[model samples]
Target: MLISDGLGESVVERQHAVGNEVDASVQGIVVQTGSITGDVHFRGGTAGEAAPRQLPSATPHFVNRLVEQDALTTLLSGPRAEGAVLMSTIDGTAGVGKSTLAVNWAHRVRERFPDGELYVNLRGFDPVAEPMTPNEALGFFLAALGVAADRIPAGDDARAAMFRTLVHDKRMLVLLDNARDAAQIRPLLPAARDALVLVASRNRLDELVVREAANRMSLDVLDDAESRELLAHYLGEDALAGDPEAVGELIRHCAGLPLALGVVAVRAVEFDCPLSELVEELSGERERLDALDSAGETGVRAVFSWSYRSLSAEAARLFRLMGLPTGADIGADALAALADRTKRDLRRPLAELLRANLVEQHERGRYRFHDLLRAYAAECAATDERESDRQDTVRRLLDFYLRTSARADYARAGGDSRGFVVDLPDSSIEGLVFGTDAEALAWWDAERHNMRAATLQARSFGLNEYVWQLPRSLMFFFHLRGYADDWIEAYTCAIESARFLGNDYATAYLLFEMSVAHYDRGDVDSSESYAAQSLPYFEAAGDTHGKTEALIGVGVMRVERGDLEDAVKPLETAVSIGQERRDLYTQGASLNGLGLLKAKLGLFGAAHAHFEQALRAYREVGENVGEGFVLHHIADTHRTSGNLEASIEAYRRAAELRLEIDHRPGAAASLRNLGNARHESGDLTGAREALQAALGLYEEIDPDTAAAVLDEIEVLPTS
Candidate 1:
């Protein structure tokens, strides 16, 4: 039976289910009903009144996933008797054929649903526009279901309810492909038991599984046989018949991923190279990933590029910057630093990347790239990103690390001795401002690998100043954390870069910093060599501060080598030069060195005065780390002078200030000193408590110190 209505006209016609016929026409409209069964069919009508057939054609050369196909069929069939709407979610990683399976299944079953089919690419993972809103999806569904434009509700909930009401009695097949999540798909679901919905997504849609009772099917990379069959279907049996081994190698290289296989097959057909030769070219991980490109946008990188290009500008920029890190995953705060964007400002752009499936949020507030996608993003940066822009972005990242790490070092060490000469570039985003040493150390732990990579990257680009400054900024952190290898590698690059730029001041500063790093690692000879190299450069640059710092480095190395007399001479010279210039940092540093020298020589009163003067200078300069150091030194002088009470009080104050700054290592040192003072005073219980706390802090910041503290605690009196 057929019925048609147009502009206040009606026409009807009916053909016999057996032999009967019926027909009716009014103006331009026609309607017919089968005389035997009373079934009506409309032949002519306004297009709006007719059932909409919106299903896209099924994918060609689709091969194998028979199990998934069967599972879907069962889901639809099982739910029919319960009078409940059948909804199945197909979820998987990108290019895993979720969309293909959903669409193919929809086409296969279209005949069962007499009301016709509906389709929409929800574009949940599309990089271009925002994910389809529920209200928008409902409106599209309503129009397709023959609801007038004006009648559709304006609000999302109202539109959804209206859509459900309209589809309540009809048997229809609806395909919601590439949906972002259950929230976006909920409003578009039909209420009718007779209708079936099939959705595809990269996410599992677990909410739908729990709340809506959705039948879920997860798609995985095809099996070897399935991948082979699919490839043969595309390239023809004849093409693959000659070299079975090469075909197997090609499929293995594709990792049974359907998108990769399709891309490779398309290229295999277009090019004349033997499949074996192609496999050889794609053997390398980087080249293999890149080789999956097809001209029709089917290549792995090309497909990724399409998704990448669809992202908002900020999200796109973030995606490209993600390639800068060599780590497997990154926290958002580090990513914010890399992009020079505030963490708050990055939330939406990061969410956009998640929606587009360009990046995955594997853990709360942490994201990672698919291996192939990372390579693709790197390619995009190399090709599309301007050299100047890349350099500027990299500089911002390096500057963020340097400035923040310096702040952290000051909190921990009581002073930063590297002495930056070049002014840092202005940051577009507010850099991290750590309130505690713990916060700063945590940030450093997270970004250590990226920090190392940035130094090398800067060196490669001849950003000489950054190459030197970045490593210098990291020195204190490395010393406290005992990262000797990273310290040496970074300084090596910085030293070469400083020499390349012919900046005598930077060269001297870097050399002094390298000496400190090596000395911390117990490489006394290397430390002295670097310190000796720095002295002439400091003199050449006419930098009295640099000269003072270099002299201190030389003296400290001599003290470590047990050349007490030689150490005394350079240490005295540094103090004189620092006093002449009124360079507070260098002067305080030199005073501390002289204090240590005096203490080594058992000149307790002289050491006390040197430390007191250093403390005053450090306070004048607002260097809390320097104050902590001098306070600890004063405590040592008091202890050596047999004033246990004074030494205990000094250590307690140093520990308190160091802890406030989150300086775990410094706090531990003070606590260790305080414990010894308490033990000397016969306060065993107090000694134990202080020693245990010190051990815990040491364990987190320096395991070697923690072990020594443990030995000290074990030997203490239990009573």
Candidate 2:
């Protein structure tokens, strides 16, 4: 250990003005003043005449030939020269020499800090390895700082605090190289005012600016002169002088990008080609891009590829698997769903990707890939995909979403059952939420496209069950997004899938949806036909829910056709089944339909009560649109029974909530009802205005409703 002795005029100033002079020749770990110097030597049985394995030679003059980032260099070097705590950032794009600059700067300033300089390759961009954890890097740092393994703190934060405490009041240099982000670098920062931190990352360390002053340097491609000097220095002073124009072209083609320069230089050496010849070959864009990987490292792809090749089997598989997804980025929880694994199982692979620098962890548990890098991973997956493997992988991904989404839907629907008894991947669903209404809605919104693709793809694979279940799972999004075509297509596909799967019960269930689509399209006969087709299947399958849906569809069709008497039986049966099943969304739809039928049949009291129950149930199940629709129907019942004031209040409530939920058709209906109530209450002018507005929207999506509303408007008394 090293401690500094104060030497100043004032007592406090003198105590703080400390310095250390480490003795180079210490037998064991020794502390003198503020410096620790120790000799590290070991002898083993095989040490006799044996040599250490040689590392490949690093590029010569790699640091010097490059132009320095003055702002970053001055910030990092100046503060530490006089003993001050500083954090400096060197950030740049791929192949920008961020790491080289940081490392070279550390070495340059090492002599000033006699308390030992430490470096950790955080591996921010390694392709397959995970970023080194704080504890792992800190352990290595502590050992370098003469702390034994047993004495190291067990926890990461503890270790970081201890490391910082140990280095406090000492003039030391700390270099955290290739860090992913400030969050990853913050813990490792030394506590002492005398210490300096040089952090290199592709990401700008904006976090440093929040609490402490930080100097940031962003690097771009080297200038033309700098590029030429580096090339001449590497290849010989006269190597490119004869063909200055060609040399300049080569540098320009390399985009003055340092990584490209190194790659081209290495290739020039390997092939013994003159700079002109290399330039000629590189004039083709393809050859120039390939040359970037000349040394199996340093170039963007080569550096990335080297990291990728070093992954474990699981991590490698994951890296390739992410390529299969159509989306650019995936939340970690959704990724775990895609992998058919738990988040815990996913950690190693995610870490490996982070370490290798292939996958970028953008936020607190979120990850993404660079666009070009994603293209590369996609290429890898395409080449790697066997027919069977591709099918199985897709099936697994679809099944995971279907099952998880089903759990979320059930939770949102207020079903108190133990989250869909399915074979879930092992892990607590901590990050993957499902219990709350908001959580379910959020999940559905985020995964809507994936769900659609998966549903369509699953159908192609003969996954009939998935086709039906997937549509069912996505009901919330389909309804919310107002994706009418998708709703029709998904349900149509589900109907075919149900038939193919030999599940007559599911076929009947989907026929109910076909009827709803037909009704939406104003094809009353088609709606009736599909609804009638479900009855026999429901009887055979003994599915109460399917029976109720079919009955509601038939009742609605009859009501539309003015066969109110015929609609009564099916409407009552549907209401009974919905109540018995306790399926609130289905129950609400049934009750709303039955309530409208009763109001038409001159049973206003029954209709009003039914509509109230429907509204309650719809709200309970997080179906606000349905709740609003029922509120409009409740107003209709009130208006029919001559409770004009009650009808106006109910209509107003429906209109407000309907608009909030983006229920355009429902809002139009509610507005029309409000207009009718207003007319009955002698507000003829307001009635004409409301009815005209409702008719316009109804004409757009439902012309039949518009015509009927128009007839009602014609009969309204003049103001």
Candidate 3:
């Protein structure tokens, strides 16, 4: 019932000699089991024929869920469920064992469905990962159901329909675990009457119960007996036999929560300490609800406080400092910077917290607090730590995020010609190191929520410099990853920070970035507004690069909005300014904007000349991606001018250059254009090859683009 890490079934290996006779010169003679067989053939069915068995292993020492388990079984098997899909939602507060119960019930019911089970941690409340969207979850389901990757639809609606169709007659168990809301889980449900879906969440999915007729079960904390039983199960009856009174007190202090009891039990066993000592500590922590918790009598803060108080001084300090940042989790390196300790010195303290369950090592090396635990830790920080110390901790933490983000930005850009520099604090000088763009991106993806939270925290603390710089540092990553909401939010914060600090230079820079972000999100009006607003500040600050950037932004927006006449003057002015200052980055960007305008105006020769100039400037600064952009534009001009051969060559070169810098979306676009150009030239074979490659890349990053490309591919000639 439990899913193993490897493929569900083991593969058999057999060796057989097919040739007629073995030579005497060979080392050994072959033995025939029965008789020589005729030629053997291997037949292939659809790939991934077996449904995915992704259920996590059930928890060990699961205790006292008899009534809840029986309720679930009755819901699943009752006669009222004869012809309808059974949907059950288990909801509870943090540390209430919702996921544990879900997994346990799922494993028990594994045999009820002939088709295998599928599970995903939606990470709805995860501080690090954004909750898994319905579309992404459906894609995973479709793949697990053996749908060929290329056959999967590129939109959520189509994918959902396909998923419903695939599971229509099949009896399967679908588990949507840790869902944030009904919307995230709804599209992933199978429409079949025979299939059952189980959802688990921290909040009650009222909509699912009301709209979808889901059976809702609200799991409360364990009762005193159940809590005591759980601890006894983990620590053995003999361990509790000597001090029944202390065990009762421990159970009372744990507030009947499984997670809290488990933490206390782990410590009781690890240190071989008397439960009476832990009880005393819990009773000694001022006996009040933690600042973050509103629960009066059922406070888990007492348990958290007791465990926290038991940690070594070093571990306890690190735990309080971890509360300073608003990020959901903190990486070990960032933790070091926050504590002003080296990575080597952090291992033992981190390990200490991990052992006590004050912090969880979620991913391999990254750690986070449970939402409740994080609140408790923050409360400790506010009550026990000095205000100045808290501010210093926050500053160090923000410094780490900003400096690391800047380094990642530089790495991803492949070296910037803008020559912008971030002055990191001495403590942050040895922040996280990334060796490659891919590594940098991976770290960014993991830390994105933390970064956003840290930015907000900086602003809240009146750290204006960090407020502006943090968002600026993250701009490249956010833009490249297409996080429009986060990009806009961070930029808005940065703009306010700049204004508050009365720094026109920073204001101009952020406005320009915001314009670009808005443009990327297709908000042309806002993009133009921000772009126009940036010009005056740049002029007042006498920042030529800022001025040139604003001009180019305005020009690009005008061109995109089809105002060619208005676009030309600003672009030309930007180009002139770039030339005067010899700023190659700005010059290349402006020339590219002009080329786009000229191309749109049907001045192909003029467009080609501008693109050529842009390419030369980009290459002079070693900006391969910028050069690729210019090359693609040049190819567009060539195509418009009816020079098919030149267009094809230019597109191919552009695609290659983009790929060389790992600009996959850019490469995919160039390849798609190349395919269209080749098709126009009657090269069907070349067109199909290029489009197919482009489609693969598009599917990874932009499924809507992939869908359009698929339509184009379908219209191409096959012969």
Measured on C-alpha atoms, candidate 2 has an lDDT of 0.68
lDDT of 2 at 191: 69
Candidate 3 Cα deviation (angstroms), residue 193: 7.7
User: Local error of candidate 2 at 689, Å?
Assistant: 13
Candidate order by decreasing TM-score: 3, 1, 2
Best by TM-score: 3
Cα-based RMSD of candidate 2: 21.2
lDDT of 1: 0.75
- Model 2 per-residue lDDT tens digits across residues 1-719: 24223322211222245644544433433334333259745443322222211111244556363346455446644644233368777787756677767666566566677666777767676443346557567766765665533334334555675676557787777878778877787778786777777877878888885655767778765777788877876687777877888888777766666766765776677557677776655553332124234333223443234344567888878887886655424677778766778889998888877876678886566677754466556556666767677666666677667777877755553453211222333333333446565566666655655576677667667777788888876554554434455567778888888788788766776776677666655679999999999889888888666777788889888998999989989988877877777778678888899888878889887888888888888777777766877887788778778899998899988888866755566778788888888887888998898899787656444445667999999998764
lDDT of 1 by residue, 1-719 (tens): 44444455334343444232334334454444434356545443333366778886687878758999999888766835354678889998777788778888888888898888888877576432245567667767877776544333334555666676567778898889888888888878887888888988889999998888889999987788899899888888888899999998877766677877876675666466688876765563333233333222223554354466668898988888786655446777667877877789999998898877679886688887755577777777777788788777667667766677666665656553435545554666455688876677777766665567667667766777778877877776775554565688788988888898798878887888788778756799899889889999989998877888888888977876788999988899999988987788888889998988888899998888898889888888877766887898899889988999999999999999887765556788899989989999999999999999997665444455667898989989888
Best-fitting candidate, scored by lDDT: 3
* Global CA lDDT computed for model 3: 0.79
Q: By summed lDDT, which 10 consecutive residues of candidate 3 come out lowest?
A: 1-10
- Each candidate: what lDDT? 0.75, 0.68, 0.79
Q: How many residue pairs of model 3 clash at the backbone?
A: 0
When 2 and 3 are scored with TM-score, the better candidate is 3
Give the clashing residue pairs of candidate 3, or none.
Answer: none
Ranked by lDDT, top first: 3, 1, 2
Question: Which portions of model 2 miss their true places by more than 4 Å?
Answer: 1-315, 327-329, 340-379, 382-392, 416-431, 517-526, 565-569, 572-594, 601-627, 640-643, 655-719
On a 0 to 100 scale, what is the lDDT of residue 141 in model 1?
81
